[model samples]
Target: MQQVYPQEPRPFVKWAGGKRQLLHELERNYPKKFDTYFEPFLGGGAVMFNLLAKHPDMKCHVSDLNSDLILTYVAIRDKVTEVIESLENHSKKYQKNTNFYYYHVRESEPTSQIEKVSKLIFLNKTCFNGLYRVNSKGKFNVPLGRYTNPNIVNKENLLTASRILQSSNLEFFCRDFETVLHDIKKGDFVYFDPPYQPVSNTANFTSYTSRNFTDDDLERLVNLAEKLDSIGCKVLLSNSKSKKVENSFSSSKWKIKEIQVNRAINSDSKKRTGHSEILVKNY
Candidate 1:
């Protein structure tokens, strides 16, 4: 496997709660070794890309409930050239009228896979704060960002990611996180980065999809983690530093640590940096 791209492959979209900032701490806590890797909450795949960069041939099973995100992965993995071309068209049209073109694409419902993926990337890049939020009706409702020049067509990163996806034995899914329980086996590593529990009343931004990841969902996730632990699967999880999260994994079987992280979504510069998140693992 020759490394063609000079840079490392990365996530194509700007996903909320993406782990790009926490990669170092995450690498430190990663299990010494495992047979395969599974990430049920595959937002912006920073951890997966980091692992794949080091071990290109590692078997990976990643999934997300956001169908559009999964479609972008599939499109890029299989049809990167087409996706690039479509994105270029978007880039051109966007320059002519940023606000109008952005909103038009946002309101559109493209039927083709390539079009849908390209539209998603365009919206992610041009949307406010690079945030992926939707209304209860499943419509992308984020307004246009203020970026004078957003990198809507990131060709180099996309190419690198596509090459990696083509070379690796990876599986992508658009399903509930709990579904992985049926396929996981002993010694497999599963890293869960579900939507963080809101620390404050004003911090609720879990609307990655139309279905918000609720408190009930978090409880189900805790149960799923325990089940994975009992099945002998190496499990790791990341979430906001909240009492609910801390108390849920308080059992003796888990190794809980608090790591500092920066919050990018907050509008206030004062509140944007120096936040704490919990990393729980069962080795």
Candidate 2:
């Protein structure tokens, strides 16, 4: 297949805890080839896009509990021209009182699918540290980001992702992680990029979506991973190097590996680099 854009596909949205930094190490650990690729915690789809850009014909399935995020993916796949137009309008309106525009869009509850996705991508790029946090009522609360020029409409990258998403079997789901149970088969590769178990109390930022992915969710995830392992599916998971994370995957069969990653999106700029995260696998 011919590449539609000059640059290869990547995550268009600047998602927190997105795996852009860890791709090289992940590539080293990836299967030489696999039947299907499954990513349950598809944040910005850093890993998914990286793999998809290289392996366009690979059957890839992704999901997130964040419905709005999934909607943006769907919009990009089916209504990209409409989304691009809406985003361009957002770019035009943002020039005047950018701060006011940021909050105004944050508080919006758009009924149209294109409008909702445009607002989501716009806020993701322009919000503080590219953070996507919401309160109990699911209202976005992150402040305006410190950027002189946020790419409100990255037409090339958006179009590239949209084209890549137009693959024959590019599936998206807005369901809980364990729902992928029955579809997975032997020789498939499943990469789990769930919200990391906070290494420190001050570093916890699980509100990527409206709900917090607590330790309980991690437990459920571990059970699912084990199920996938028992059924002969190869599984890999990423998480903070915490005692809980260590204990959860301490079984004799699982292989735990640690790698360093920069904490590029922390609130406190001083502590925003150099941290260890664990990659647990059942290959």
Best by lDDT: 1
lDDT tens readout by residue for model 2, 1-283: 5443356677878777889988999998887868999998998999998888887778988999999999999999899999999999999889878989988898888999999999999998899888888887788898999999888898988888888899887899999999989688999999998888887767788887778988899999989989999888989998889999899889998899999988768888878777889888876
The local distance difference test score of each candidate is 0.90, 0.88
What lDDT does candidate 2 reach at residue 69? 92
- Record all residue pairs in model 2 with backbone atoms less than 3 Å apart, i.e. clashing: none
Candidate 2 Cα outliers beyond 4 Å, as residue runs? 1-6
Candidate 1: give the clashing pairs. none
lDDT of candidate 1?
Answer: 0.90
Judged by lDDT against the true structure, how good is candidate 2? 0.88
Looking at candidate 2, the ten consecutive residues that score lowest on lDDT are: 1-10
